[model samples]
Target: MTQPSFGVIGLAVMGENLALNVESRGFPVAVYNRTAEKTKTFMAERAQGKNVTDTYTVEEFVKALAPPRKILVMVKAGKPVDAVISQLKPLLQEGDMIIDGGNSLYEDTQRRTEELEAVGLGFMGMGVSGGEEGALLGPSLMPGGTPEAYDKVESIVTKIAAQVDDGPCVTYIGPGGAGHYVKMVHNGIEYGDMQLIAEAYDLLKNALGLNHEQLSEVFAQWNQTEELNSFLIEISAEIFKKIDPETDRPLVDVILDSAGQKGTGRWTVVSSLELGIPIPTIYAAVNARVISSFKEERVAAKEQLAGPSGKYEGDVQSFIDKVRDALYCSKMCSYAQGMALMGKASEEFGFNLNLSEIARIWKGGCIIRAGFLDKIKAAFKENPKLPNLLLAPEFKQTILDRQEAWREVLAVSNQLGIPVPAFSASLDYFDSYRRDRLPQNLTQAQRDFFGAHTYERVDKPRGEFFHTEWMENS
Candidate 1:
């Protein structure tokens, strides 16, 4: 079997591992990075015998690959990408495929695609997840661009993409920026899912006053359930239960309570706000991270603060059950926000995307992979345009059966003042969005004040418009 020609343009851990993965998949990888030292180092470490050549120059790098090549750009998302693209602009010939395999902004991807198209070059904005290892083996690949370019590269991508026992790891998400946009939402949902786990951990720690092993035991039990089974859940129990031999206590305690968030978490919150999708859980999760960063603030407030915070004692199982519900509901809200974003992007970008396929592909490998994915896969299969996760028969039934338990948890958490921000935010978004009238809709008024953005009237165009006294007087 002849190995197809491909080059990796970055040699970071992610890039290096990915190159090796491509090699493992039987495609000889030609890797080049901005730093010659790193490339030389990587070549020295691995490139031996008759298998490959490590080129020192862009021209040499381009020549090392077969014609009509597949060159994947895996550099840092922004300026580094532009610089590399500019360098390759002259080196790449007509009909070569350039894939951006970083966490790039989708809009920028669109702009670059248009620019590259003018030069007879093809572009694919890809979203690669599963981190370094995922890249080394097979990460879920979301490729968006001209179908011709995708088809040109699909042979290798399909052969190497990550999978469950069944579903494929790759999808030609749509044309233009659709792939990256889908990926952006994938990160957003990831934020929601992780935060939900954090909230559950908090509830268990607080309500039961559980120690590390106890909390670990709690998560382990949660994983036994079908709804919560996932990579995040499984590994998190490990994180909780890990003990320090010297300290004889859980490592999580010594670890700071602060959660470090990469930009994707914040991007999910901001983009959802722009699109008018209520992703309160994702937002609150981001906000929680921001608050976590306030180590000094807590200290400062302590010296100037008034009274001590209250404590609580309740049925711990009842508390756990409710926290579970809130997490599930928040999970639902985040998924809804993600699907909504996809729907909007699909319409706005003129792309035909299979949301069910997206769900099916997400089932096993990625951070958000869970049993819930199957329900989403089934729901969308039943109705591709299913309004939300909650509307799906299985999910709707799950929520309905559990709502009584969930409400009690929310009620107690509210009483306890344990800062159930993400959980409550999701519940609030759910109840209010379902409601016909939401008070304090200053967003409409503010929009009008700035751009003279006319509000739609409820009587006409849903009669959603608010009449200003100044406009009436004028």
Candidate 2:
């Protein structure tokens, strides 16, 4: 039997599909699961007649691999990951590598990498995006580890990763959990994108009084535009057109309103707060999901709350265009926030992340894939030290041109009693970012007055602090 070049632990959907992907790319793979029956079933069902070897025991799985083994772990994040690593640590030899392809907290990845390296073993925290189908086909891959570790698995991963005209959607994403950190921010941006789309749909349906068909048409048209072309918008158009066979109604209408999250979005917000970076758009999106989970409270509040009682009474087409512009503007702000957070994280954590490379790879396979990512890539390329996406000339001009329409959409939504928290938050973020002078002076004075915290003087040199006695030292 030919020695398998790669080994995979866990027989879940992601693991199974990724193993198959490697096998299909002409590399022999060894697969294993804790349960022997699952491995037996996988070989009988999915791996039959393929270049895949199935092993039941941890020893067999380890022995089946060739020297300098490359293993990919696709189990659940956190404790399950630690357990698997613990089992494999004693069995694995020097120079062998373990890659974690789960959505783990970056700090955990950092710890794992440090622990494994001390014993002459290679560890990488590689983030695989694009879900199950992407695993079988190709997905965007973010690998962070030593260059030596990346070189060992580079041939296999690059061959299996989603390819675009720019290059394969996989790269060495710096070291020490940089890959996972980027993936976390990616999920956070995805949350913001989804919330923004939902708000656009809500405004169109409730405010403009569009039915399912018209709503579908609106999203379909928006998808054709370069500015709004995205996987989320593309699928949203399809979602609106889906019919529930049992009820014979729009599938979306039949579905529950409460949304669920799997912690990455919340983690992004927490990281932003700790870094003192303002990601209001992403924060609002996470908050919106939390609020959505309180379906009963929202339902009860609907009856108790009193506000404006009529639909939008304006030009429908004009308002539709404004909503589109507003959505695009807000979407840019969300991306800006995420990118800025990564920039700050890179500085604080010593993760020399290539922002351009990250944006370029994200152009395909990932949920956030879009034409807009190309613009981002170019923006970073043009100015590698670009502080914010909003400051890029192209983005700046587009937002300036569209600010009026953005304002008008919010005004209309407010008038029609529609809650566009993500939209509103994004606009405020944009407004705040672009402003040279804000009302933080009063905030500083209030803080000083209450807590004796010193305030910086604008008239003096930067970083000069002053403490004023309010009420004449009384």
Candidate 3:
């Protein structure tokens, strides 16, 4: 007999599909939605045989499950998660398991886990990715909670996850909030990554004057390259190839440049700033979105500031090639920034994370899933504290070998007044690395000399900080 599985709370598109996925994988599931009517509606739909089943509200949801039940919560992050937990507490018995499958903040997950653990309830904060389709067809799963709790749920998650030959789309990341924290960071990285692709599209459309089919071909070919291969890259081809019948122009040209962004992109930029990671491309992406919001203002600015705009002149292929390099470089910056946040979170949360495993799981399961994910998995498996993603050997080699090409691309784009945000950032990071000594250190020294701020000793042993060095140097 199939074990009874219940998915509590959100029964939106992702949750509904996931329930279907679980049922398809041979588990009988009872689903609950916040609105009692939604549950009834779901059951009625299932009765009509339209993608739903065993639907119930909070009370019926609890009663339908067996003792020591396994219930997964799929609600909006923050207050909604807490609200559902509060309402469900009275109905749940001791030893029941609840998994948070939403995009909640990690610290909140950790706090909630401890709170639930005090009452003998087991908690798992899981990060589910691959969107609605992946949810139904086997999305990537990251679960963090008690090892024992994960062990109890592992088989269920694994069986329903996407398979890449042998590996499942699921893994137990760490203890406490690690799962959700990883997920939050995962979303953050996704924001930057999508933005870079958009920038690439914009560059191709505006600067290179490539038609939809040609641009689509470029992206399609890029998907085959290990350096730029990703689902995003692959999809870029389709987005470009889309054509509008009314005007007979590529659909991309008609789409508004001022695209809407969810909170994740803004959160990524904010989090990166807090973590002190350089993420110029991600920042550019965020800014670009913001700029889009002021469509009228921009139009006004266009009229007010209009003058001679620089014309992009050069080998179109060569410029395209350079833009590709820039995209990689900016992508590295965003990855580095996102990882830096994880490092800080790890220190704060007391969970030892495995970056390699993070990379491995992301390779095929998440939106950010891509060929380079394998490189990250390898790099972190070798050196966990890695300060920058670019320091990852493959990335290092890519930047070093193709750096000239990237710089050339940025140069040509600038010459033509093409605003290549990611491209510009890639060149900046590369040029900064090429220098033997950073002038920022000199500026820091000057700041310390005047402000009496603390400074690190150059001559002292490693990992030492010294304020007296200022006195000696001055």
Candidate 4:
């Protein structure tokens, strides 16, 4: 029999779907699972009548593939990934490639790439987005590694990736873990988008007194708008329409108040801090999830805490419009922060990332995919070194035009005791970005006085630091 074109280990839902997706694209695939039953069941069920081979061991799986073997590991991140590589190392030959299709920390990817390359093997850290369904159909693929490894698998990757109007949503991100880093930032932006949508839902329900159906209709309408059109917003509208079968209420109402995270969002925030980059909107979203975890404390404090108790008396439709504007403006801010983080990482790590191509690929098949990404792509193409998305003319004008309404929505939400941290943080980011100067001068003075950190002067040129000895002067 002819050797399989590719191999996939880990027959979990995502792994199975991706394997099937590859097979559907006319590539022969070899599949394996740590558990023999899963491999047998998958081959009997989904892999039936397809060009798929089932193998029980890592060695068998590797041997089933053609020369210059390509294997995709869809196992869980961290130790499991390392274990899989260790198991495959002794069986695989030089020029063979291992692709990690898990949500791994980029640093780990870097180490793994270095280790494998030293042994004459090629490694690719791939970021697969669009969830389980997308896995079966198509997902946005970001693969980072040596060009030769990417070239070997480019046909399969592109054929299996989600396609937008322009092309398939797959790209060679850069060398050494750039794919995972981009995916981490993508999750960070996803957190911010979800939190922003939640804030909009709260403001509409609590302040504007819109019911579930009305809110869904409003979001449906917003989805048709250029600025607010996105996968998250579309799903959010659908979510609002879902009624709980058991309770006969909106499903969201019956769901738990607390939220859960899978760590990628937190990784984004931690990376931003390490890089000295400001991603307040993403940070606020992560913080929001953390605070939501304190459900018991929140419930108890609800009765103990006193907040504004007046009903919303604003024009309801006008307020809803304001909320929509706030959502769009904040969404822009969050994207700006995410892109800025990527740009800084690209420079710092010598990835030489193409920001425009990244935006183009993200326009579809990702959690944060949005229509506005087209504008972002155009902006970066117009000026590759565009410092921030907020400064891009397309986004700048929109933010400037909608600033008043955004401010009003935030102000109203604040007055009504609604927590809109993502919205507030995005607005704060905008305000800080547009300012000619900040209060950091006083901050520097205090630092200098206490820690002798030194401070730069406005009258002097930048990078010329000075120290003030307050104790000696006194």
Candidate 5:
């Protein structure tokens, strides 16, 4: 039999779907799982009449693929990844490539790449986004590896990636885990986007007294607009329309309030802190999830927490307009933060990431895919060294125009005892960014007094640190 063009290990839904996708695109694929039965069952059911081979062992799986083989591992991240790599190392020849499509940490990818390269094997740490359906159809593919390794697999990856007006959503990210790093930030932005949408839903439901139907209609209208058009917005509208079969209510109403996360958002925040990058909006979104997870504590605290308990008597249409504006403005800030973090990471990690390309690929398939990303792409294309998305003329002007409504929504939410942390943080980030001067001088003075940490003065030139004798001179 002819050798398969590609191999996929780990027969979970993601792995199986991706293998099917490869085969559908006319590439013969070999598949394997730790449980041999899974490989057999998947091939029998999903791979029937397709160019697919099922292998019962690692050696058999490796041998089934063509030389200088391209193998994708979709198993769990961390130790399982190491275990699989260990198992594959003995069976694979030199020059064969291993692509990790899991949500592994970028640092881990870097280490694994070096380890594999030492043995004359190539490693690609790739980030595959757009969930299960996207896997079965197309996903945004971010692969980081040597140029030679990338060249070998680029054709297949591009073919399996979601297509946009410009091109496919797959690109060769920089070497040594840059792909996973970008995906980590992508997930961070996803968290921020979802939280902002949730806050808008809460405000619309509580402040405007809108039912699920009205909420769905509102989101549907917003999704039609250029600024708020996104996959998350589109799905949220659909979510609001879903009815619970047993409860006879909106599915969202029957669902629990507690949110569950799988760590990418938290990883993004940790990376930001380590990089000394301010991603306040994304951090706030992660914090919102953490707070949501304390469902029992929140339920208990609500009885004792006292705040305003009255209905919003404002004009409902006007309030809805303001909330929509607020949501868009906050969404822009969240993207701004995520992009700025990526910029810092690129410089720090020597990734030489093409920000415009990243934005272009992100315009489709990814969770954070949005119409606004086209604008971001344009901003970066206009100036590759653009400091932040908020500094772009178009974005800056829009935020300025929407600031009043944004502030008004925040004020109203606070007065009515609703917590809109992500929205609030976005506004604060905007305010902080535009300020020429801040109260940090007082903070510096306090630090100096407590720990003799010197301070720089506005009256003097920069780099001239001043120390005060507070006890004697004061």
Candidate 6:
């Protein structure tokens, strides 16, 4: 009978777990779902004897919470989110805030925030990572809104966020769509990480002739290393060890080759292109997924297209070491690309993001959680104006030390006809970033000759542009 301090809309797995997380943190929570049966079932199964309240109607859901209610909406992104907000808007009074805890497009979040704030209500676009189990226990929370709005729920969110030695994996990202934008970039980096890991697995299995068990062991060993330690690597090791009950084969081997995507990766790539930031590694990852989805085309082409007939004939242990080094170096470049894209986006969108705090919050709970994030946190802490992660002294030394191994892996993969798009793209990005001069001078000359785009001259101030009639009216 005690008044609930917070409310949750939607009874999906994430919403249910998040509500339970709040209740476990000693905050009274009211939960509601459009379908009353879900609410009934959750209250019976999950919320039994817990300090939770269930409301079957929107009016009841709104009234059960104390004044100036903080409601976390976990519905599907897009239209469903708009629908929920519409329903809540009419019943709620001024000062009641709605927190969208879904992977929504940041533009939509920007629009919703502007609209709600115009009407004297509060809106926050919060990115909740760590999936279902993390929601029940803890999640990495990225909230973007007015400082006052975030302050209202800071205690509850911080207590429920994953804790690390530095602090909890939660922070006020920035105003507008900054939180969702960060989450989108997080997913982009995830895409790059996954693709790079798959390349390593492919190299081990196809190039080195290692079986699933050996693959599992290799990843497990890599997980113990300082650089390659990550949730994805840890889970990949377990994935290779899983046995398919029906086929008695490695579960991953028995699974389909095609992959699916939910658009966040594509969004990141598109945003980077619009902002003129080069995130080639993430772009390659997204394209890899797209190519994977074309299984039929790939199967047909595999027969028609000819590939290199040679096999890898090298020292097995030495090649494995090279592959590990390549993965680590390529992974660093991929992260650099994502971080640089975020830096540019922050500038364009006025997010005023704290890159050090962002890295600190990602050290745990999230899918991209890795040991290297500590270095990133330290890098930004040491220089808040750090333009790119690749320029950080610690990271610079890592790539420099590992570039030879990275190039060796790529060379071997290329000779063996193994496609390593993410690896190739990341190496290209790294090489391009390190180079003081590039062949782009020819590109600019060509552009100027063809289209008169006006090229900047090296002999003049950087901003001065010139166009020459290369053919001399011939």
lDDT of 2 by residue, 1-474 (tens): 678969999989999999999999999999999989989999999999999998988899999998799999999999999999999999999999999999999999999999999999999999899988889999999998888899999999999999999999999998889989999999999999999999999999999889999999999999999999988899999999999999999999998999999999999999999999999999999999999999998899999998985788879999999999999999999999999999999999999988999999998888889889999999999998999999999999999999999999999888878899999999999888778999999999999999989999878999889998897966
Residue range with the least summed lDDT across 10 consecutive positions in model 5? 305-314
Better of 3 and 5 by lDDT: 5
Residue 389 alpha-carbon offset, candidate 3, angstroms:
3.4
TM-score of 6: 0.98
lDDT of each: 0.79, 0.93, 0.77, 0.92, 0.92, 0.93
User: Which pairs clash in model 6?
Assistant: none
Per-model TM values vs. the true structure: 0.91, 0.98, 0.89, 0.98, 0.98, 0.98
> Which runs in model 3 stand beyond 4 Å of their true positions?
1-3, 44-53, 245-248, 307-311, 385-387, 433-436, 454-474
Please provide, for model 1 over 1-474, each residue's C-alpha lDDT reduced to its tens digit, 9 standing for 90 to 100: 243479888899888877887787778778787789998888878654425557778888888888898899988888988988999889888999789999898888999999998889999999888876677777888889999989999888887778776656887888887788888889888887887788778777875687888777878887888888887888898998788787887788788767796687777667777776677777888888889889888889869865534444766676676777767777787787788777766766787889988887787556777887888888888998876777777776777777677777767666665667777777777787667977545677777777776676556767565655446666
Residue 9's lDDT within candidate 3 is 60
| Candidate 4 wrongly placed segments (more than 4 Å) | none
Report the poorest 10 consecutive residues by lDDT, candidate 1.
305-314
* lDDT for each residue of candidate 5 in 1-474, tens digit (9 for 90 to 100): 567858999999999999999988988999999998888889778889888999998988888888889899999999999999999998888989999999999999999998999999999999999998889999998999788889989889999999999999988889898999999999999999999999999999987789999999999999999999999999999999999999899999999998899999999999999999898989999999998989999899989988885557888999999999999999989998888899999999889899899999998888889998999999999999999899999999999999999999999999999899999999999999999998999999999999999999889999999999889965
The stretch of ten residues in a row with the least summed lDDT in candidate 4 is: 308-317
Residue 46 error for model 4, in Å? Answer: 1.7
Candidate 2: regions farther than 4 A off: none
Predicted candidate 4, C-alpha RMSD: 1.1
Clashes of each: 8, 0, 1, 0, 0, 0
What are the runs in model 6 whose C-alpha is more than 4 Å off? none
TM-score of 1: 0.91
Q: Roughly what TM-score does model 5 have, to 2 decimal places?
A: 0.98
Q: State model 3's lDDT.
A: 0.77
Q: State, as a TM-score between 0 and 1, how close model 3 is to the true structure.
A: 0.89
Which structure is stronger by lDDT: 1 or 4? Answer: 4
